[model samples]
Target: MKIKPNKLRSISIVKGQLKNVKFCIGDDPIPTVSEQPVKSLGRWYNASLRDKDQVQQVRQDITNSLENINRTLLPGKLWRLQFGLLPRVMWPLTIYKLPITTVEKLERTMTSCMKKWLDIPRCLTNISLYGKGVLELPITSLTEEYKFSKIRLQMTLKDSRDQTISNAEQPIPSRPQPSSERDRKSPTYALCPTPATLKHILTGCKTSLTQGRYTWRYNQVLKSLAAALESERNSTNSLPLRATNSITAPTFIREGQKKPNHPPTKPETGQLAMARDWKMLVDIGQQLIFPPEIAATTLRPDLVLWSPSLKSVYITELTVP
Candidate 1:
């Protein structure tokens, strides 16, 4: 191979101190020393040989990208953050060795930007931001992405064809085991006298039932649904009517028989369109009583909508799994 002495750069990496290094190509001295950090394969390496510089560079890049995104006057901020920013951030997180604390800090910055973009209060918890609630929004958590990327990278390394890596003994960490003493005398055990499993804590806990946790969650969902229904019932726009004038073509025809042609008539409007008086009863603070005139039953539904003029009623029941 032909060597270019002028293009070559040299730097000595040592534990105590970096020594002045010189290189030669066939006794021709190459005196250039690369004092600054060098970039190779999208990662920076300096004399220190640590990833601190790379981490700082990544942080700066992310901060600048986030600032630019915040300045742009665009709709679908959440969409941009999820599809655009997250992928860019995950690439670096997957390649570089970063501390969990640094990832958490980056997440905090992203979270702040998200709340600002959504015009939500800063006091809102992170759980509400990422949780699958009644009115859930599309959002991604950076910390979760970081962890997923690391795990994927680990799996790739573990399955690599390189003999050294494949044959090397790697320690696999296990999750912390639950204490037997704590399990027997857990707070939930005192109330329900059952094993402290996830199902019991979420649904079957006697203490949780007495505390109205399930009821509160159910009511929250019911309230949102009822509000939307109430708006539709009170709307000035006419109710959606089925198309009666248009006729659907027959799927099959006999060998000797011809297709029938029907004349088009005026579309039929809904019967409730003429009746404007609509009343609604929601089950929140009090039990929902079904109208005795409509249906003589003891069943207490979640919501009831009735129209006296049309002599029609709509009953709704909400269940969350």
Candidate 2:
């Protein structure tokens, strides 16, 4: 096949590419050379044949597109990111070996835009948002989502192929439990209750509580429950029965869940200051506990005071908002 000068491009994939190498197409030396990646079949490939260039290009494009988006779109930009931006990135994520740093960069860009869209102040930290119902998904979470997408797509493709040969008699594999008996007995494998597990259980309860006869808001319910628990503690002149043995509850893996409200903008430095003040203010006979876990549940009171004279515990939820 005859190739025109305009259709020809050359690049070196090797380190320290050889110099003075010339090529001739029908006795005409092709002098023009380039190292830039070429686009073909709707995909970009660099001379090194590595995915680095593709990742960089895709990131740049996404960043540009995000910059053009208006911050006033309520949830619309988020929806677009989930459906449009995410789908576009999937192909590159699967085909290219993208570094975690690159993924983090993408996440940071998205997060910055999201915060702007939400009109959230810069002073608010991720932990604060997490405390409330706002979902503060990390960069790794987005990567995990892409991985799931790739796996789902592969499974679908495999299923399609399997259906074509369903008529053929296939040997069924032996049924073996995915988990080993030893694994089940291992300490790591044991289900231990964690703050996360407690949160999940509580959030599930939240859903039920909201739809039930009690039409109270989630925060209101939390406050009411805390107050009731405090009252019980006061009457007993000791820890509430619900709190007994809470420290040694069985542990389990914790999954991320959406919080009902945004956490107050309390920085770690400020929290430390509050802790110091609490230590100084309490009397000799009283004990102050920060973030008292209730009945091993994830719900925590910001401050709890145990008064020996009054024989009661008081719960406090501090707010600087």
Clash count, one per candidate: 0, 13
Q: What tens-digit string does per-residue lDDT give for candidate 1 at 1-321?
A: 888776566677567777877778898877534465556777766766778877998899889988988988888777878998888778778888999999999999999999999899999999988877897767878888899999998988789899788756542222234368676454434454455556676677777787676687788899899888777777723555344467988568889998777676765345346556778899888777888778888888889888886698878888886
Candidates in order: C-alpha RMSD to true structure: 27.0, 23.0
Residue-level lDDT of model 2, residues 1-321, one tens digit each, is: 668744565653346764545566787765534443566766676555667767778888888778656544455776676677777777777666777777767766776766776689866665543232456442234556666766775666666667655424333232233277776543233232332233343343444454442223434554565566545444444322233235765645457855457567643331222221122112112333343332344445555554433344455665432
The whole-model C-alpha lDDT of candidate 1 against the native structure comes to 0.77
Runs with alpha carbons beyond 4 Å of true place in candidate 2 = 1-5, 11-20, 27-36, 71-75, 121-141, 149-321
TM-score of each: 0.47, 0.37
Compute the lDDT of residue 44 as modeled in candidate 2: 71
Predictions in order: lDDT = 0.77, 0.53
At residue 180, give the lDDT of candidate 2. Answer: 78
